[model samples]
Target chain A: METLFSEMQGALVVMPSGRLDTNTAPEAEKMLVDRIKGGMNQVVIDFTKTDYISSAGLRVILKAAKLLKGSSGKIALCNANAQIFEVLELSGFLTLLTHSDNLETALGIVGNPA
Target chain B: MTFRTILNAAFPPFSEARRTKPREMLFSVAEKPGIGTTFTVSLQHTLIVLTMVVYTVIIGKEIGLTDAALRGFVALEIVVMGLTTLLQSLPTRFGSGHLIVHTPSVISMAAFIAVANSFGIGAAAGGILLSGVVVIFFSGLLPRFRSLFPVEVIGILLVLLGLTLVEGGVQRFTGLHEGSFDTPTLLTASVTLGVIIAFSVWSPGRLRVFAVLAGVIAGMIVAYLSGLFGASQMAVVSSEPAFAFPLGNYQIPAPTLIIAAALPQLLIEVISAVDSIGTAVTIDKIDDARWTRPDMQMVGRTITAHGAGLVLNGLTGTPPLGTSSANLGLVAVTGVASRIVGTATGIMLVVLAFLPQVSAFITTIPRPVIGALIVYTAGYLMVVGMELILSRLLNSRRQFMVGLGITVGVSLMVMPELATGVPGHLKPILGSALIMGVVTAAVLNQIFRIGISQTARIELSGYSAAHDAAEFLEDRGAAWGARRDVISRAGITVGEVLEVLHNEHMVEGTVNLQATFDEYRLMLLLDYRGKAFKFAGDQTLDLAAFLEGDEDEDDLALDAAMSQMSGALIQNLADKVSSSSQKERAGLRMEFSH
Candidate 1:
């Protein structure tokens, strides 16, 4: 998985392409953690280009959610396909996180003050 | 096994299984359905599916998924299976429109288990999803990869898969989980096998349809009588609800595991797709008088739907689905391959999915009974593999490759110590005998390609057959160094032959094309089980009709004129065109030079 970082409304928007699993999770986790540590606590992961996600990928987002919560930060997931959304729902991540159908909606969630 | 032995042992007769002449079909694809007959036949199909649904339960237990999760997963799996069957049975561009039942595939279980064990269930789920994507891609570029898998390789894989399942089944029978090899369990298995064999051979008409169910019931009776069941097992019947909606829990898979496990999964998917296609082709041969190869468009689409089904399985946390050859065999035995019956079967499954109580009841079947069923299915699988190997001319070279592949696979599978020397990560591939066999067969297949002709073969079906065949020829010809004009000419010639065949009342799904490319020329051999094509010797081109023709000319007239023109064009384009027919197999051989 390769993440292309962009900013909208001062919130970092990360778009991941290809797969988000064990092979790519480490790089993705480090990138997200580094940004959170660097004080860019507001994040949105765009999954439009990413077609696959496994448990290893889920753990990264879970960790990020936990990390951001301690610092009063927010994370929003956007553009998840049916498979990804179902995975998130089954894993109980949907209850713990906020999701939007598109970047515009996601940015609104991430832009709000905690 | 020898070819004769396989034929004799197809389903192993207790009293010489009487050969039922392939039943005459009561309904054709185009025939309208009767409510009573549709319901009756559909019920039979439903029974077969119910027997197969045990796969999901076994797989769920094997993977250590929670009970609730398993139930929900099975619910979704049943629904997907129904929808897939409906898609396949419908007269769609991508479906075979045959009574092909889609269910959780036993062949892929070994790979799924390996992935689950190595990474996690989530990773296995991810791998299943990835496999779906891979299949969709494979559907598009089928010809290029077609050579990689032969009947011999698939045969090895199938036999290995059967052995693996049989091993699992025997372990279950011996109560390895409970660490016992008691008399009760032994009696239960024996009775189940006995009842199924008795019903299959001695039962009359529709009673044969209930053989599997009856056998399981009989085994359960024996288990209960033998005091195998406890109050705890029976108590769940009342506690379970009558109905519940399917709610899938989610677990994202590991990418590394998905990638690592992809090779084995992809191989399994390819075999499943090919097997399903073969089944569809066999049905086509039986259903139509002018049988061509299976419709490639429909076959490809059906495969894509199957892939989509797998993705659904992953999203729902269920095992991957494969086409059930047992159902295909049912279609043959029962002679009711109607789409309406398939639709009814699908609806029945969807209804059953919502009935949690029914699922709860199925769970009560003794482990030994399930083990017996698995063993029976595995026996059929082994025979199916041997039949596939024997389908083609098995030269000594092929015999050696098959022997080597099987020996290597079984050795690795039977003896775990052989894989112990391998590293941890690679164990998924090296550890399992099925994967080992698959890799071996695929590698040897590639290596033994030296003496084989450099040819590409594709099965084309439906109205799109001509177009896809044309495109395939042009694409493959270009890849083999044919000039643009030569490729174009070759494509046109192939299209023309198909058009001529169509004109002769050839149904859309019966054309197979094999093209061999050499330095100087491209030799295309087309086969179909239909009326032989011969160009009309007389050319009656009406210049007056052409001159007087208006834009409002009848479409029928224009079609007739164009059809006639195609024959002449084919003659002009190809240097030599000849056709021959032996028995029911018709061949059109055309040679196009650069």
Candidate 2:
């Protein structure tokens, strides 16, 4: 239902909350563009408070991640719940997007990818 | 003859013989007398998107990635996807009364890198936003443009787009290159495919929800079991929520650059609306001829709404995507309109919003397995495209052009992107292949038009035949319903008045039941639509006069009826009309029981 993007250090961190369903995926997508245009290459999308992800939502994120790859940028996700994780895995997002245990980890990993 | 006479004649055993006139247009579900199924229709739409997305992903892979190219590409994808969801959701929410299709936009996507790389990232982003604005502004004009771009052409365009994508479909079975395939990948893909097929064929109910999904699941299981994946294989997605608007530093580097990106995006936006509407029209036509469907106008509304969604994409951190052809594939199989599935799908998406780990797992679905899904979808598109040509676009003269044109046109684009020296004039436009295809097709079609008549009667005989059939249905079923709905509404008005009168007290004494019944009968006959045409003509309904006459409150029968017709007295005379038709109105059974 809502996607919030902010520059955390040198990386863009996106925290999503609410339903994030079909009607709200656009908000998530818009957040991605804003960060990219704002010149933040490294991004983190947090799903700690989110509920689910559909094919439409996954596609938007995949597209953004793919774009980031070109800039030598990385996209890391954090705070995903169970159902949300299951949906991502099912739709093949696991291969395209990265995840972290918490906000700090996500920021650390995206900022300094080992 | 008055309306009563006509009603009598229509059901008469004692009257003259006459033919029943036809009703106007009808949708397939509307033609049938039952509650519409949600699952099947949702599947069809899902299939369309699934198929389209599979190929789109392949195309995305093929397009590869470059720093600048990736930015523009990502932005374009985000824009398309974001807008598409909004577009599809709009009509479903606002215009459920009509049929409206929302699908992918291929036009602006191809040009994403071209315009962006040539100008700047800000320019491209601004252009994307501006494009949505244009679509919103001209949303009203889109349906009218349907006359300009016929459904046949739209169908042809899709067929061409599908044929072009078939290469990716083939790559599903065969690996992309020399080292892409192995026993594990093949076995996993086959197992997944088998699961999908068996579930699709044998299992019913919610099993359908995850057949493709299950296939991916099974494939991933097999992949992990075989040591194909490990900790190092994990992918991370952004967790940042979207909070910005479409402006800021993403602002146009220059006003001129934004304007430059506008034209191409507009063309694609329009094309997207047309393509979706055309697909809906075709699918809907197959079932019911009497249904009134949403037109290009609704499509425009949906697209404009989608564009507004794109502004969100700019504000968010995701890439834009348009409607996926996967939905079209869903429509093919289910033939129902269960937007609830779409809603469910949205739910699933929101779920992913909270779980990047889970989404990462989905993305990890083996490439070959993903390839399998693509193969299924693309193959279906080819089949669907052929169905279009064979069913609607086929004919003697135009068949050659429609068929061969689509084949060759799509094939040429698919054959190989010949990176020839970029022409000076085509510099701005040549960046996107979809744009090039549109220009090429238009040019070729125009050239062909010199020798071929632009408006020839025999241009596309099959297409014209289908159109004629649609027209025939509209004249009968749609016309009938319209006529009936009007008269029934009118009848209800007078009926309600009479119903009130039947309960009214008169002269502070006994109710005049006879007077009330007569007034009610007269109102029923005159205020009905079917009754308006009760005279010599089959369609003529003259219902105004009888209903307009004033009834005196002095009538004793009406007063008596009012007294006698208590709640306990005439429960049997309750309204029985379900459909809004004059016939239904006339069938209202106000009976006198023992």
Candidate 3:
């Protein structure tokens, strides 16, 4: 698995490719926590390339959401496949974060693009 | 342990152990009653079997046989009934090892009369011989066509059999003598029915086993007092010889095979075999508390015995024999289903054939009394048939199969003229409600099975994922003709697995659900790009501790608890559960026995 980070509308966009399971979750968590600590708070995780998620991967996203919430910054997720979306809905994670079917709507949820 | 100690441990003493009987049965199929109990029960069955000899009498009269010839024919029938009944109760290659009594078949009576009318008694005998061979041949093939006679189809056969008896039962009960209601006959029938119901329901211990006998004796007394049993009926009994050989005076005719006579008889024999199947199923179900499906092997043995009886009938120039449904009802009501009773009854029948006067006296049983017995048996059969039908998971296809099958059968019963326009030879198939109903149900069952695939697929995702997965399995299960209980379990297991997959964030793409079903088992496969579920050995969840835990720990505790619950539910619901993962893709398989 590979984690791709980019900037869109002043928001950090983190795209995870392949599976976001136990083997890759720790690395994804480390990268997100380091960026948030460096004062990049407004974020959107794009899951267009990611096809699987486990409880470990869910914990990584939950930790990032908690950190952003403490900083009073918004975080959103976009482009998650049906399985990932179902997982988020069933786990009660959707209550803490905003999500959209596409990246543009997700970026708008975090901050308006220029 | 030593060998002696180990052997003693494995096998308990008889005094320390008790064999469990089915709740409905007093004496099970394997249990043997004492001589006194056996004799009385056998006598009750013998009375019921004797009443069916009126069909033989009718056929004899129709065929214009001499009075002495008619007596010989009736004697031959009684002998065949006895031998076949005895054969059916024995646990041999030919017998079903159940209490299946044999009697002259009303279907064969009609076919024989037709053949006799067209050709002669010699040709009729030859036709019966051919039909017997065909019946035995068909018995071998019936087990292969097990899928055709599903529970619902057998239900239709049973219901039709009950319905067919209603015309005669109600007529005799109402005492429609000379197109007028006879008060005496009605009173006698009511008393007979009343005593039977009372003894069956309220009587205690050994008294209950003699319920039918009590009812018959009471009915006979009522008939004698009401002038229904006059000196004229007694005269007929007195005129019969005290003891005579079956073939002493009557001459045997050389049977000549005729295609015109044998073809219709062969067709009717096939339908009669269907009746034997229903009887076999009824007796099998009565014997076992946890009967899941028809024991086709035993059923084949039953038909084999029935065919053997027909073969004997052919050689002796008598009417073909069938498994008696009335005796089955008697067994159920009296709670005595011992095969020994069957043996005793058969012996009594053969003994009665020699004592012609005794058999004549039994035939003098009032029509109303016989009617009451038929009504009781009809009620029992119809209820049992309905239970069998409801035992299956019915979709629209199955509903139509059962509904239309019954409608066709009942239609012929209500409108006898429906077969009047058909050719004379086809009347046997189309005229009889039992034959038409079973044929329609079997054919419709095959027709409705056209588009139903054994395997089905659906994509399950989103908030209603679990619900959607359950519904998909149910619909497909019904279409594949799976048992209701098995299908329901499958649905519940799939729902539980889906909940786990969704709640644990286990899948990242749509979960593709695929189901495959054969008669014996159902298999479900779920594939998705996801993490394999981690089923922890420990399933116990500390609800109290989780409730009192810190908020951060509470969420983690709930997640662990839900995963444990999912694993436990999946394990209990399915016969087998297996999971496999390759790289990023995961698969879960659940199997349920049908």
Top candidate when judged by lDDT against the true structure: 3
Report fnat in order of the candidates.
0.00, 0.00, 0.00
For model 3, residues B71-186, the per-residue Cα lDDT tens digits are: 98888889999999998887766777778999989767778888888888888889888888888777766777899888889988889888989989989888886789889989
Interface C-alpha RMSD per candidate, 1 decimal? 29.5, 29.4, 9.4
Docking level of model 3: incorrect
Identify the runs in model 3 with alpha carbons over 4 angstroms from their true place. Answer: A1-114, B1-21, B177-180, B531-566, B581-583
Q: What ranges in model 2 sit over 4 Å off?
A: A1-114, B1-87, B90-107, B179-181, B235-257, B278-294, B314-320, B331-336, B347-351, B393-396, B417-419, B422-594
* Cα lDDT of model 2 by residue, B322-432, tens digit: 545545443333333333445433433333324434433444556656666656656666565555444332233444445455644654565435535664223334533
Candidate 3 is scored at a TM of 0.77
lDDT head-to-head 1 vs 2, winner:
1
Which of the two, 1 or 3, has more lDDT? 3
- Cα DockQ of the candidate 3 complex: 0.02
lDDT of 3 at B9: 41
Candidate 1 has what TM-score?
0.54
Chain B structural similarity (TM-score) per candidate: 0.62, 0.56, 0.89
- The residue-level lDDT of candidate 3 at B22 comes to 76
